[model samples]
Target: MIYQDTFGFAQQQDEQDELKSFRDEFLFPQHNGHKVIYLCGNSLGLQPKSAGQYIKIQLDNWENFAVEGWFMGDDPWLSYHKALLPTLSGLLGANDREITVMNSLTVNLHLLMVSFYKPTNKRFKILMEAGAFPSDQYAVESQVRFHGFNPKEAIIEVTPRAGEVTLRTADIIAQIEDNADEIALVLFSGINYYTGQLFDMESIVKAGHKAGAMVGLDLAHAAGNVPLQLHNWGADFASWCSYKYMNSGPGGISGAFVHERHFANDKLNRFAGWWGYRRDKQFLMQPGFDPELGAQGWNVSTSPVVLMAMHKASLDIFEKAGGIVPLRKKGDLLTGYLEYLINNINQKQGEEVYRIITPKDQKDRGSQLSVVCKRDARAIFDYLAQNGIIGDWREPDVIRLSPVPLYNSFTDIYHAAEGLFKALGATNA
Candidate 1:
């Protein structure tokens, strides 16, 4: 697997790629009359070409069926989301009964917390990684305050060791063990949004359970970008946004996962609505809240058919490509090539001009490589943008370049390296 810093090598790799045709399925943003090298799937993915047709079908249904669209169209609005569960459940490694498509990421997280994060006088704290996405921090803080507990006293953050960019799995398990008595919930991102370090979900779950605390995950960055086994790992609950790796469009409909063990646990609390009521008895307009038997019981309002249609469009592509396994195989090669080229750039400079902070092992990271520019960081980022290299930027100095396997080719990686090289010169770094 020797990587060469040449266009010919990249082209050769692309020629051998079985999933190469998937690149043609997406619509990329144009720059200077050419398709831009989009390396920002970590933020938002490119639109699937089929997305329009998917939406049009629903729009036409609304036009033809009017209010009766709920029960009348080819894909009745009453059960539109059910068709999506098979593919979504396959991506999450969970039973169809355990997954449901619903509100945005944080909203789902808050709703799940209502069911899983049951705090008491003895165990009222929540344990999580430091530097989590601000939304998670805010959600946990507000939840803690709502229960009349001070956030400072109710939240425990696991920090990396001195001078380390990523957290070690041992440290995470130890933190869970150390705070076992006071922890009511152990929540963590499946992959850290900043470092791109994939956590050991199975070990974390076991440790949390041993400590008598519930475990949950925020898979906003990990959902479609990497393979997951939420059921096997025994995570109590989880939520993820579909926009990034799943490519369902910006602010897309999010999803949730609740283990079967909790399906019959009526002790859990939920903010119920008509959508969550038992489907068979729903039309009766009954009295008490009688939820559906599985994760669909968490649904709050009517289904957003259009958003689910957009999601179905991308998921059909995944099904055609044979699910996350093949995608992950291609993703590993694409990201490894990017890492190799970045290391080559640093070697050529004879100094560490770009320091990658993401985990080096493929098992510990997805498609993203979070690089820290040692000099002229902002200018270098702008230079890449001007050259049509679309990467994501974080404050201070980190630049995230993610080579998505579904639409990205090895040639894209080669050109991105060229952009980085030219950017160094353009910025005089």
Candidate 2:
């Protein structure tokens, strides 16, 4: 699709957007009494307008039912997360029994590793993409050390070829094959947080399985942003934070998926809590850990009702929007417009003042475009802030702008590009 470099063109696109009214569902941050162009949904999603109301219902249940709220209320706190599974199942492409909501992103990652990353002396190493999010890096390093192996020896990082900004699928598969002997686990992010490169999870899973290793994904950036068939892909396990694309509140409850194949496997280890006990006998206060049938067996604590309420509020909107298929359609065009405008700026300037390090192919990325400003990177970011364009910044350079399909409009992307264009002149002076 050819894009025109004009505000009118952007407005026209927004006008034709079928999901345009969905923007009104979220509460945007204000700037100078106006809604800012919020392009940081990749970091923290905008809050849904109904979030407070949803929380109030839970608050009311607590007030009316007191200690009985856990079992007596219309939506019992004991099984609150059960209400979320259908929508989440659709978003994640998993069966209702395969997914469960619990813990934060990194915490779930550690919990899952306890089960999936058991390594013998020969195949003790973990293979991952280079430059994984710092939390994952720390988690893997500590997990390796806890098992009495040096991180430098136990972690194999698959990096891009010297000049490339993204990993080629062949390189990733070849690396998995190259380390087949010593690698016990293959862990990767569904989308690299830094480069916004969406990895080929299906190919990666098939390769890792053939090489005799378990594969898992940290879907912090991928979960709701991209369509995932975790079960069909045969990934052993995966986890994601809801605060980003799922639009649960900041530090919202995270979720995990375990393939149905793992459900009956007694060989897997877990650090269990009462919440994971079989629901019927959980209240009997039994001794031996009789785990729940599926992913819920991984739950280590009681449900956080208010957070689940907040999450349900957002998922309701996704369900109303007909899930991700329609949202992704508008998202691609919105992101494409921003990329086209940035490239046009470079062409007119007669130099590559802004280099997009994210993959150029639509299939290889989501809404994020990580643009490295060749000049005045910091000042330019500040200028966008002042003008109510809120894209996040990485250290040294690279302004990360993500046009969220839920709340962000095509006009938002256009104005953000306009602010960036003006920032060039503002910084020059």
lDDT scores in order: 0.95, 0.94
lDDT tens digits, residue span 275-392, model 2? 8898889989989998999999999999999999999999999999999888888788889999999998888889999999999999999989999999999999999999899999
Q: After superposition, which runs of candidate 2 have C-alpha atoms over 4 Å from their true positions?
A: none
Model 1 CA lDDT for position 341? 95
| Runs off by more than 4 Å, candidate 1 | none
| Residue clash pairs of candidate 2 | none
Supply candidate 2's per-residue lDDT for 388: 94
Q: How many backbone clashes are present in model 1?
A: 0
List the candidates' TM-scores in order. Answer: 0.99, 0.99
For model 2, what is the alpha-carbon lDDT of residue 113?
98
Best model per lDDT? 1
* Model 1 lDDT per residue over 1-429, tens place: 788989999999999999999999999999999999999999999999999999999999999999999999789999999899999999999999999999999999999999999999999999999999999999999999999999999999999999998889899999988888999999999999998898888899999999999999999999999999999999999999999999999999999999999999999999999999999999999899999999999999988999999999999999999999999999999999999999999999999999999999999999999999999999999999998999999999999999999999999999999999889998874
